[model samples]
Target: MTTLMEKAHAGVVTSEIKRVAASEEVNAETVRKLLADGFLVIPKNINSKSEPIGIGKLMRTKINANVGTSRDNVDIETEVEKARTAEKYGADTIMDLSTGGDLDLIRRRIMDAVSIPVGSVPIYQAAGESIGNMSSDDMFNAVRKHANDGIDFVTVHAGVTQSSFERLKRSDRILDVVSRGGAFTISWMKHNCMENPFYSEYDYLLEMAREYELTLSLGDGMRPGCINDASDRAKFEEFIILGELVKRAREAGVQTLVEGPGHVPIDEIGLSVTAMKHLTGNAPLYLLGPLVTDIAPGYDHITAAMGGAVAGMHGADFLCMTTPSEHLALPDVADIREGTIVTRIAAHAADLTKEGVREKAREADRRMAVARRELNWNRQFGCAIDSEKAKMIHARSRNADTCSMCGELCSIKMMREVMKK
Candidate 1:
């Protein structure tokens, strides 16, 4: 059987690409070209019957919600609810970074519950107990376990090689090695006095990926943690390795997505995405918050959206939504809903700027313009992305047609009345 990449190369549009194009409201050939060029990827394992979700260039920017349990918080029920909340609010995908009790069961249950593409970082399970005991074999076994369980995508920290560590030692960043997976791999390398197994034994990983047809999310282990650490030596060194791994993976017939920066200042986000695209040859870039500011603990979602909009508009393919619970605690159901909606808004805003991106958002904005001209509250709500929230907040304001901020002297409403003949 031909992989999606092969089928695409042969000019055969697979069902996955077709579905993605239909969802994005673009031509299937556009999607096929993106896939062939390694700009877009449909993460669906061969053995798994899960539906495909596209992430990359020339498509609607997709958002992914991270839902999992920490050791202190191990409620499978709550995680499932968060997953459901994410789906309801508009998360294109979900990554189960579970490290708590019953890791395998939690993942399987989440997969069964959600129709969206599911992703997992296998190293989390390998190093869940302690970073000391996490050997290469442990990591490999965990990835295979995830593949056997039908995870649509697996994040492998294959870029944090020994050479990258050498680069990190000379650099002085505010938060050195903020990625948990990167920390684990670096610790393992220092302890064993050996090279990174993921880099050394990449073919074995590629074979596993090819067998399951799993999309390898080449994890950004050396990504900057703080705004000061953005675009440092450690980050680029790992990226060079990731680019090589991406070329090799494509040769092995396995799909790939390149994970990107941890946190970056607003001005630097564009440069970060552009550099990654140039280095990695435009492979799908999945970014964390790339949070613009260091402050705003409770409003990281807003901070993330600010940066995400820039990243998506520049070149990023996927936006990982940061909840209000970010840098604090595990997000509950409400947090997931808010995070997903906020990120979706960011993605849509960015899509408007991107060439040949989503049309619905722009069309909705056009409808809202018409509604404001006609003084139609119902139409305004109908055109809103979060109509329920808009309606509820408006209802609490004491003004039926006008919000409390504007009241009876609403400019738009007043303008409509004055302009009427």
Candidate 2:
């Protein structure tokens, strides 16, 4: 039962490696080397039939859309619709963070509905089952259940240890902890007066991860909630712990990636990303917003995209889509669609500056530019990230060759006439 990492170390290029290689347009050997070195991760649970995706060095920056039901809004059908809509709109992965209803059924339904890798935060289910009476065994059991259920990846707050908790107490941050999983781990630790089980029993966790070839997304439990709390001592302390854990996971031949900050000032996003990458031995970084500003409750998606583009430029490997309802409410299908497209745009925008994929990303922009210059409305829509949205918006304008804003005063048309003369 060799994991992908083990297989790669053995120099065996498996079908997953080939599929990822073809999708990334990189050599199969390059993918093998990256996987073997623990720089690239292809998260495919053995039981999952989802497509293998390469995330990390030399691969296009990927976006993940999170869809799930909260206790207040437990509509499984809507959740499933959001899952399919996310994939259709260009999400590289889907994470079912359902905390209500039958968690297992919802997770499996979402997995069956999409062809991309699926992830989950096991602690959510553990807490749902045993809010105040959660035992160390309960947490481990949740992890095992998700792995056995074929979740491609799982977010474990192994870094929220007693030591980091002490550091958190020493700090006077505006927002101490914003991550739901992080808060859960801290609450369990405090209530039980014990160390975080995931941290204390990491070896056992590693064994289960290896058994399922599960990619451990070492969750940033101490991620800053607001811009004011960015880069605090507690956050960096947790990062140091996660860095050590990253090495341990790699040594154990288990796939892993490090999750990063939630909210960061625009100027600090790049620095934060670089420090995390260096500290974690350049393991793939999956970022949640690092939302550049604290304002814009309704438009957090735009802020997240702005921050994501910067993070990607600074080598962040994956962006988790932050919907307009980020702080307001759970995202509906429309919000999921918009968020996925926006995040995909941000990922591509960052890809334009990346080394290996820059030219490939630029080619799309080039096509869009050509279409615009020629007043090729159809071609423009074809090149858009959301073709339907582009068409819908364009349909508002009566003119076929130009939009409403520049009906007869269209610059492209005027430029064409002058150039022809």
State each candidate's clash count.
0, 0
TM-score for each candidate, following the candidate numbering: 0.96, 0.98
- Measured on C-alpha atoms, candidate 1 has an lDDT of 0.88
Estimate, for each residue in 1-421, the C-alpha lDDT of model 1 and write its tens digit: 5678877877989899999899888899989888877778999987676778888877788999999999999999999999888988889899999989999999999998898989998888998678888788998999999999999999888999889999999999878898888888999899889888888999999888878888999999989888888898899988988999999988877789999988899888888899898888889999987789878999999999999999998988899999998999888898999999999989888888887775766787889989877767789888887889988877777766667887888898888778889
List the RMSD of every prediction in angstroms: 1.5, 1.0
lDDT of each: 0.88, 0.94
Residue 204, candidate 2: Cα error in Å is: 0.3
Residue ranges of candidate 1 with Cα displaced over 4 Å:
none
Tens digit of per-residue lDDT, candidate 2, span 155-261: 99999999999999999988888899999999998888889999999999999999998999999999999988998899999999999999999999999999998
